[model samples]
Structure formats: structure tokens, C-alpha cells
Target: MLNLEDLGEEGFLERLATWVKTRNPAVRISIGDDALVLRDGTVVTSDSYEEGVHFSRLYFSPEDIGFKAAAATLSDLAAMGAEPICFLLNLFAPPRCEIDFLKRLYSGMEEVCGRLGVEIAGGDSVASDKLILSCTALGKTTDPLLRSGALAGDLLYLSGFPGLSRVGQQALRRGVEGFEDAKRRHLRPQPRIALGIALRGKVSACMDVSDGISTDAGRLAKASKVKLVVEYERLPRHPELLAFAEQYGGHWDSLALNGGEDYELLFTASHDLPDCIADLPIHRIGRIEEGKGAFLEIGGELRPLLPKGWDHFSK
Candidate 1:
């Protein structure tokens, strides 16, 4: 038997996807990108939040866990530029867990679903030794934006500043005070659904920055068969990230490039933005060139970026 840890998350996923693709010809989009799109125009994605792995009761409330879990699946739909229709939840917990705790979790999911105009279509509940929450979001799009559509001469853009969540997680772990914004970001992530909707016809390729730009950019580059050159100084770091670096002696650039869980949309477009794209909150950070692999340019020096983003199996 092959050890899953030896493959890492990406390698394991790629191998699994390759096997599944050979069996199912109807799969429009499979395992490589953020979500899977079917030929019938249905876009589906599922993500899970595990106890101790994704969150801890020490820093997150039941409501926060539920909300973030929903966001994880919804963010995938957003990356595909799909309109969310409904969400289905799979919850597993110890039998002794309080009913109120479960209610609070449902309340959190309801809050996010209400805001996103998505309906809770029902789900299954099972008893387990530990708390596990998983969500499956269903959506639809006429023309799904894919990560393989990028071309040379395309400009790269990010929906918003990165590293805020990383800074927030650090603040929470270190018990650092006065970074409420950062903490809130970590607790409650805002998926860029509206921005994805607006970018439907404009962008050549799109994906969410859940695994940090350093890794996700390479995924995009590999899928599109182009080279991505990101200018280090052009990366927009959150104000809280800068403050965290100043007070904690950490590198903000490192966090912005390598830290995961931002959920911001990363896309590529032509040199000139359409009038529709001009009004959206976006930052030009890089360019796509004719080549392979992703590189970072710092002070006029270019170097290939190592895969330092999140990996479930790699410690």
C-alpha cells in the first residue's frame, strides 16, 4: 500500500483526479481546481472542518466554526464564478455534545447563508468521537471561469490584501492584543462572491487564494501553461499584517506570500481592464509570460518560488 503522507495533499489529489477522470467522462472540471463543474452547468464543492485540525474550542465558538465551514465550500463556488443555490451540511459529533452548541452552529450557518442568498437544503447528522463539520455547496454558472484559461500577456490581480488571516491566527495563538480586525478575519472570512460575479466575462482564469499565492499561483501557472511573475513589492499586505510584523518581528511579506486561508480571488486578465472591472476592488500584482513555473521578482531579482503553502499531510 502506498502511504498518503508520502504524496502530500497536491500529489495525492492529482493522482486521485487522474484516476477518476478516466472513469467519468462527464466530469467537466475535476480535482485540480478549487471546485468541480458538471456538464449540466451545476458546480459543486465540499470542504470539511475537523476538530483540532481546522479549529479549536479554545479560540473559536460553535458559531464561528459553522460560519467558517460554510465559507470554505462557498469560496470554491465563488472561485468558479458560480451563483450559489443551496448548501448541504454533514455534521458528526459526540453524543454527549450539548444541543445548544449544535443550535449555535446552525445559527452561524444560517447567518452566512442568509447573507449569500443560499438556502440550507438539509443534511445528515452522525455521532462521532470528535466534532466534524462538512459542507457541500451547489451552484450554477453559464460560463464557468477555469484556471486553465490564462494566456501570455495576461495581467494578474488579487481581490484584496492577503496575510490578514495569518496575522490574526498568530495574534490568537500568541494572545496578542489590539488586533481585532485580524482576529475577526481569522474567525469569519468573507468570500468574494460579488467580485467573482463581476469578473465572469473579463478574466482569463480565476481561483481563490486559500493555499496562499505562492502555491496557488503555481497551480494557476501549471494549469494555464504559462509563467507567472509576481512583483514582491506590488503584493498588497493588510495594514494589520504590517503592524503585526513591526511589533512581533515577523516578516509580513512571508506571511502574505506563504500563509494560507485568505479566500481572496486571484485572476488574470488582459493589460487593460474593462469598464466593469475598473469599479471592483482589485490590485494588479503580476503578469503572465510565455514559460512554465511561477517566479517572484524582488528588487529586480527573479527567483522561482518554492512550494511553502499549506499541505495537510506535510508537517
Candidate 2:
């Protein structure tokens, strides 16, 4: 049996990359550079996640971790209004990790992949002191939905309600009934894959809400070089948020504006919006403008949409 522990991270990655390069003819490039570009596409993005930083075992299971990793990256693909075809996952875990952990993780990943009809082509693993997941999702779109695609007079739409994860987190902190459902959402977020594919060609610029809404929306608006006028009243809200709002001086709007891990798509349709997007709630939340900067209009009040998302480097 080969002992991967004996090799350092670099050596193991090199050997693994070489193995992949030799076995898979479809692999355009493998590990060894600042980044790896595996296949061809007009749009491509890769995301990395850490254990304690992104999630906690006490709050989420291994299966949940696997599901979250895959789902999150898929959302990025969706944001571009691209249809995801395949994925590559690289895992780093300590030797002491339980064997069942890997199985459950893969099982969760397989569940989401099967639902989305995405392929798990290949991945590389290695021994490490902690768990880290790096997923590379490949997608294709004849007309890619970029953040820069939003034009003036275009309407913005969101696939679903927000604040489930936030309320779930707070509920867990307070011991509530809906906490599990909320935690599950926080753990295994589902990316709007079908809707994204369906919205392709039908919409102008598109992107997913990974960071908080206010934060992510700002990103899309900035990328498009256009101002965003979001009608906060049009935003869909969960009962938990509405309930939590009345008692706790609810920042429900803020949560909806900037809550991370929703994994839903925030897209723009310059023409008429789509007639159908299944299994997910889609609503027109705002519009695009030719100006610069993003703002939110709520109850006849307007405010700047600040970039207040999850920034690992922020102090």
C-alpha cells in the first residue's frame, strides 16, 4: 500500500497531478501552478473552504460539509447563468479522521450531484492536520450571465427567501424547534442549478448570493458597472425572520440583504422574466441602472448597498 503520510503536501499533490494527467485524457491541466485550468469554457471559477473557518462539526456533520462544499461552488456557476456539467473535489484530512466520515461526505455530494445531474469526474486527497475542501466546478453557457451584463432598466430577481440560515443559527443559540431545519440549510445549502440553467439566454447578467445579499448584490452591481435599485419590499422573507423580527429588533431586511450561504441566485432579466423555474421560489426584487453604485429602496426609503459580506481577511 502507498503511504501518503510520508510525503509532504507538495509532493503528494505533484504525484496526484501526474497520475491524473496520465490517466485522464480530458484533463487539460492538473495541479502545480498558482491555479489549475482543467477544461475549456467562456467562464470558470474555483472555490476553497476550510473546516473551522467555514463550518463547525458540532453544528454540521461530515455529510453536511460535503454537501455544502459542492452546493456553494455550483451557486457560483449558477450566478454566471451557466449550466454545470462536472466537478472536481480535493480533500485534505488528518489520518485520525473516521473512515465513515469520507463515505458520508461523498454520499451527500452524490445526492446533490445526482439531483443536479452533475458528474463527479475526479478528485485528489491527502493527509493533513485539518480538513480542507477545494472544489472546481466546470460549466458551459452559450451566453454566460456575468455580473457585468446587467443593463439599465433591467429587473433583478431572486430565486428564494432569505434569513433561514441566520434565524437557524440564532435559534440554535437560543434552543428553538426550527433550528434543525435552519441548521440543515446552513449546513447543506442547495444551489439553484436548474433555475440557473433555465435562466440562461433569458436573462442578462446573473450571479449567486454566497456572501450576504447586500454584500453580494453590491458585487454584481459593481461588476456590471451599473447601479442597482433594489425594492426591499419585494424581497421574500421566511416566517422565522418575520417572527424573529417582531421581538428582537429584527434586522430581517439586513439579513436578507447580506446573509451568506443562501446559495440562491440573484439574477437580472432585461426582457420579460422567465415564466417558470421549478422547486424554487423566484421573485423580482429590484432593477438595474446605467449609473454607478448600488442602492436599496425600502418603504419609500433608499440607502446605499454596502459590501458587508463575509470577508476572511477583514479586520
Candidate 3:
């Protein structure tokens, strides 16, 4: 019997996508990309966060947990170049959990939603053995960005620091002091909603860097049926993350390449793009080429970049 371990996350997703067919003509895009786009300009996406899997109470406050959960789900809407309208939350917690904790969690979500002009439409609550939070975000866009739109000769760009969140996660896990910037990045990720909206007619392809560049870029390349050659030396890094890596004896390059949970935007454009978009700096890291798969250009050599990012069922 084929189990989840053998299929892995991507494998299972591919198999599951095939098994579930979309017959509705209103579904313009589904089972692929960051979110599903409807013909009526409605975009929808959802994400789930479980205790001991996505976050740890040791470092995450109730507010932080709620904020991060909402941000993650909303980031998918941003990836698809949609402006978020509202979100539906589903909370599952044990009866022993305190009401104050739940209130604080909702407060965190409320703060982010208010900033983003999103509303808490409605949700369902259920009793469970562990804490679980799920969010379904809804948005609208006349023209949605897609993963399959990239073409050869397009320039690839990345926003913000890619590995800062991983550094923060490590610092919190190891009980290391300092690295406040990195920790904040992990605890509170800012979804690029404005940037996504700005990129509506400009970007050929775009996605959020949730599963590290090595994996997410590969997905983009596969979807576009092109090769993405990323210049290793050109990748932008934050000073705080570098310091954390050095102090903790971690490989900075590895973290930048494979560390996930950096909810920054990754995109490609055929035309020249501005260095900064609405004060957010964008770095030109690579280019799309006529080939297959993803590669790393480092030290005058090209190497195959595998998907070594987070996978729940990898053994």
C-alpha cells in the first residue's frame, strides 16, 4: 500500500489534484498556483496551522500564532495578485484551553486584518485534542498572476530577505538571545498585498517564498515549462541573519537556499522592473531560460538545485 511517506507532499498533491477534477466552468484556475481564481474575478485560498507542527508555544504567543496564521493564508492571495476582502477562520482547541488565550489569538488576527482592510467574515469552532487554526481568504482580481506565465528571457526577482525567518526560528528554538529582527520576521510576516496589486500587469509569473527558493522556484519553473538559473552570489541577505548564522555555526548559504517560511514575493518579468516597488526593495537574482528544472549558478559552475525545503512526509 502506498502511504503518505512514500508520496511526499508534492507527490501526494499531484496525485490528489488528478483524482479531483474541476468541472465548473467558473473556476478559471484551480489545483495549481497559489490560489484558485474564478471567472467572476473572485480569488480564494486557505491554510491550516497545527500546534507542534507550524509553531511552538514556547516562543509563539497566542497573538503571534493568530497573526502568523492569518498572514500565511492571506499571502496566497497576494501571490495570485489579488486584493483581499475578508477571511473565514476555523479554530480547534481542547476544552482545557483558556478563553483568554483564544481572545488574544483573535486579537492578533484582528490587528492584521484591520491593517490590510480585511474582515472576519465568519468561522466554525470545534473541540479538539490540540490547537488548530485554519483560514480561508477571499479576494478579487480582474487579471490574476499565474505560475505558468513565465517565459524565456524573463528576469527573476525576490523581495526582502529570504532566510531571515529561518534564522529567527532557529534562534527561538535554541534559546539564543538577540536577533530581534529575525525573530520579528518569523513571528510577524507581512504579506505583500500592495506589491502584488502593483504587479498586476507587469509580472509574468509570481509566488510567495514559503517553501524556500530551491523548492518554490522549481515549482515555478515546472509550471512555466522553463528553467530558472539563480545566481547564488546575487541573492540578498540580511546582516542580522548572517550574524545569527555565524554565531550559531549555521551555513548561511544553505539557510538562504533551503530555509522556508519567508513569505516574501518571488516573481519574473519580461520588461525592465523598478529596483523598488512602493518603497519595497526588489533584487534581481536570476533569469528564466529555455530549459527544464531549476539550477544554481555559483563559482562559474551550474549545479542542479533540488527541492530540499520543508516536506512533512520526507524520511
Highest TM-score: which candidate? 3
Give model 1 RMSD, 1 decimal.
1.8
In model 2, the clashing pairs are 79-207, 148-224, 212-258, 212-259, 213-257, 213-258, 214-257
In model 1, where do residues sit more than 4 Å from their true spots? 23-26, 274-280
Show model 3 residue runs off by greater than 4 Å.
none
lDDT of 2 by residue, 202-275 (tens): 88877777777776787678768898988978888887777776666868887777667788878888766643
Clash statistics: count for each candidate? 0, 7, 0
Per-residue accuracy of model 3 over 73-185 as CA lDDT, tens digit each: 99999899999999999989999999999999999999899999999999999999999998899999999999999999999999898898999999899998898988999
Give Cα distance to truth, residue 181, candidate 2, Å. Answer: 4.5
Model 3 CA lDDT for position 124: 98
**Residue 298 error for model 2, in Å?**
2.9
Ranking the candidates on lDDT from highest down gives 3, 1, 2
lDDT of 1 by residue, 119-221 (tens): 9999899999999988899999988989999999999988777888888888998887888988988889987788788889989999999988898999999
lDDT of 3 at 290: 98
Report how far residue 9 has shifted in candidate 1, in Å: 0.7
